[model samples]
Target: MIEATGLTKRYGKTLAVDNLTFQVEAGRVTGFLGPNGAGKSTTMRMILGLDNPTAGQVLIKGKRYRELKDPLRTVGALLDAKWVHPNRSARAHLRWMAAANRIPAHRVDEVLDTVGLTSVAGKRAGAFSLGMSQRLGIAGALLGDPEVLLFDEPVNGLDPEGILWIRKFMHRLADEGRTVFVSSHLLSEMALTASDLVVIGKGRLISQSSTKEFVSRATENAVKVRSPQLEQLRTLLVQAGADVTDSDDGVTVSGMDSEKIGELAAANRIALHELSPQAGSLEQAFMQITGDSVEYHTGLEAEAQHVLEPTR
Candidate 1:
C-alpha cells in the first residue's frame, strides 16, 4: 500500500502541493485527478522521492522510497515516457534500467513482450511514435515486477486500442494484489478503469472515495418525465416543490426521485409516456466538484474586453 500524510511541496513563492493525506490500498487501481496545474505531477514526484517534500511524508509499504534497498523493485513508476535516451533502442533502454536496478537480463525480454513491443524492440526510442514510447515506458516500469506502480498520464498518446490495452493491463496488475495509482486527464476512461479516486485541486485534497460513491455524492439525482399534458405536469411538478427544467423531449424533475414523481403523476390522473431517472456521468460530477478550483478560464468576451479597456 502507498500512503501520504501531510505531504506538502513548495517552489520558492509557489506552493505546489498542500497537506495531502490519503492511502492507495493494495489490489485496486486508484485514479489521481485534477485540473491543469493542480500539482498532480509534483505530488507523484514527491512520492517517488524525485522531489523532496517541504513537509510531511509519503511511504510505500511503510518505508520511504529512498530507504528501499532496490527502489525500482519496490515501486515502479512512469512519470514521463519521454525521459529516456533518444538514441537508445527500446530494448536497450529497458536493459539500461534493468542494469541500474540489478534486474535480470531475461526480465527485459519478458517486459518487452508484456507490453507488446517485441516487434519494435530494436527500434530507437527517438523514432518511436507517442503510443510506442508509452509502451516502452510501461515496459521499463514492469522490469522489476514491483508491488506498487505509479503511472502519470499513461494514456496521453494512446489510440483506442492502446488505451484499452493499458486499462486491462492496470486491472491485471491490481488483480495480482499490487497497488496501482494512475494520474490522467481522461475522465471517461478513468471512470471505466479506476475503482477509487483521489481528487485534488489547487494543491489540496478535494475528495478521496470510491468511484461510485464520489459520483453519487457529487451529482444531483433527477428524473425525466414526458407526457401529453406537459404543461400541466410541469405546473404540478413545480407546485409539488420539485425543481423542473424543460428539455426537448421531456421535463427533468429534481428534488425528488423517479418513484415519487410517478406517484404524483398517477395521483394527478396524468398519462406518463416516459419516466426515467437520469444518473449523472462522471464528467458532470467532476465539473460540479472542481468548478471553482479550475485555474484557467477562456472567454472571447473577456479577451475582447481586456483589449478594448483603456490602458494606463
Candidate 2:
C-alpha cells in the first residue's frame, strides 16, 4: 500500500502541492486525475523520492521511499517512457536496473517477455516506436517484480490495440494483489481502467472515491423518455418542475426519476416507447467538477459553444 499524509511541495515563491493526503490500497487500480499544472507530476515525483516535499510525508509500505532496502522491488514506476538512454538497447537498459537492485540477470529476460518486448530487446531505445518504447518502459517497471506500480500517461500516444493491451495488463497486475496507481488525461480510458480515483484541483484533494460513485455524484442524472406523444411529455415534465431537453429520439429529463416519469405517462394514457436512465460519463463529471480548477483556459469555449447552439 502507498500512503500520503499532508504531502506538500513548494518551489521558490510558488506552492506546487498543498497538504494532500490519500491512500492507494492493494489489489486496486487507482487513477490520479487533475487538470494541467495541478501539480500531478510534482506529487508523483515526491512519492518516488525524486523531489523532496517541502512539508508532509509520503510512504511506501509504511516506510519512506529512501528507506527501502530494495526500492525498485517495492515500488516500480514508469513516470516517463522516454527517460531511458537513447543509445541503450532495451535489454541493456533493463539489465542495468536489475543489476543495481541486485536483481538476477535472468529476471531481465522475464520482464522483457512479460511486456512483449523480447522480440525487440536488442533494438536501441531511440529506434523504438512510441508503442514499443512504452512497452519497454513497462518492462523496466516489472524488472523488480514490485508489488506497487505507478504509471504516468501509459497510453498517451498509443494506438487502440496498444491502449487496450496496457489496460488489460494493469488489471492483471491488480488482480494479483498489487497496488496500481496511474495518472492520465484520458478520461474515458481512465474510467474503464481505474476502479478508484484520486482527483485533485489546484493541487488540493477534490475527491477520493470509487469510479462509479464519483461520476454519479458529480454528473447530473438524466432519464431519457420516448413516447409517441413527445411534445405532450415535454410539456408535462416542464410543468412538473423537471428540466427537459429535446433529443432526436425523445426528451432527456432531470430532477425526476424513471418511475415518476412512467407514472406521469401512465396517468395521462400516453404510450411509452422507451424509458432509460442515462449513465453519467467520466468526461462530463471531470468537466463539471474541474471547471474552476483548469489552469489553462482558452476562454474561447463559450464562443465556440455559442456557435454550436441551435437557433430558437
Candidate 3:
C-alpha cells in the first residue's frame, strides 16, 4: 500500500502541492484525477523521491521510498515515456536498469514480452512511435515485478485498441492484489477502470472516495416526463415539491423517482406522453464537480460550440 500523510510541496513562492493526505490500498485501481496544473506530476515525483517534498511525508509500505531496501521490487512507476535515452535500444535500456539493481538478465526479456515490445526490442527507442514508446516505458516499470505500480497518463498517445488493452491490463494487475495508482484526466476511461477515485485541484484534495459514491453524489436522481400540457405538468411537479426544469420536449423532475412521478401524474389526471429516468453520464458528473477547479478557462472558445437551452 502507498500512503501520504499531510504531504506538501512548494517551489520558491508557489505551492505546487498543499497539505494533501490519502492512501492507496492494495488490490484495486485508484484513479488520480485533476485538470492540468493540478500538481499530480509533482506528487508522483515526490512519491518516487525524485523531488523532495517541502513538508509532510509519503510512504511506500509504511516507509519512505529512499529508505526502501529493495525499491525496484517494491514499487514500479512510469512517470514519463519520453525520459528514455534516444540512442539506447529497448533491450539495452532494461539491461542497464537490471544490472544496476542486480536483477537477472532473463527478467528483461520477460518484461519485454509482457509489453509486446520483444519483436522490436533491438530497435533504438528514438524510432519508436508514441504508443510503442509508452509500451516500452511500461515494460521498464514491470522489470522488477513490483507489487505497487504508478502510471501517469499511461494512455496519452495510445490508439483505441491500445487504450482498451491498457484498461484491461490495469484491472488485471489490480486483480492480482497489486496496488495500481494511475493519474489521468480521462474521466470516461477512469469511470470504466477505477474502483476508487482521488480528485485534486490546485494541489489540494477535492475528494477521496469510492467510484460509485463519487458518481452518485455528483449526479442527481431525476425523471423526464413529457405531456401535452407541459407547462401544467411543470406546475404540478413544482407544487408537489419537486425541482422542475423544462427540457426540449418535456419537463425534468428532481427529488422524485420515475415511478413516483408517474404515479403523481396519474393521480393528477395529466396525460403523459413519455416518462423515463434520467441517468447522468460520468462525463457530466466530472464536469459538474470540477467546473470550478479547472486551472485554464476556455469558456469563450467553447461558447461558439455551445447549444442553447430553454431556461426554466
Clash counts for the predictions, in order: 0, 0, 0
lDDT of candidate 1 over 120-210, digit per residue (tens): 9998899988888899989888899899999999998899999999999999999999999999999999999999999999999999999
TM-score of 3: 0.88
Encode model 2's per-residue lDDT on 20-61: one tens digit a residue: 999999999999999999889999999999999999999999
Question: In order, what lDDT does every prediction score?
Answer: 0.91, 0.91, 0.88
lDDT of 2 at 173: 98
Q: Which stretches of candidate 2 lie over 4 Å from their true place?
A: 302-312
Candidate 1 scores a C-alpha RMSD against the true structure in Å of: 5.1
* Per-candidate TM-score against the hidden true structure: 0.91, 0.95, 0.88
> Considering lDDT, which of the candidate structures 1 and 3 is the better prediction for this target?
1
Off by over 4 Å in 1: 300-312
Worst 10 residues of 2 by lDDT: 303-312
Clashes of 2: 0
C-alpha-based local distance difference test score of model 2: 0.91
Error of 1 at 100 (Å): 2.0
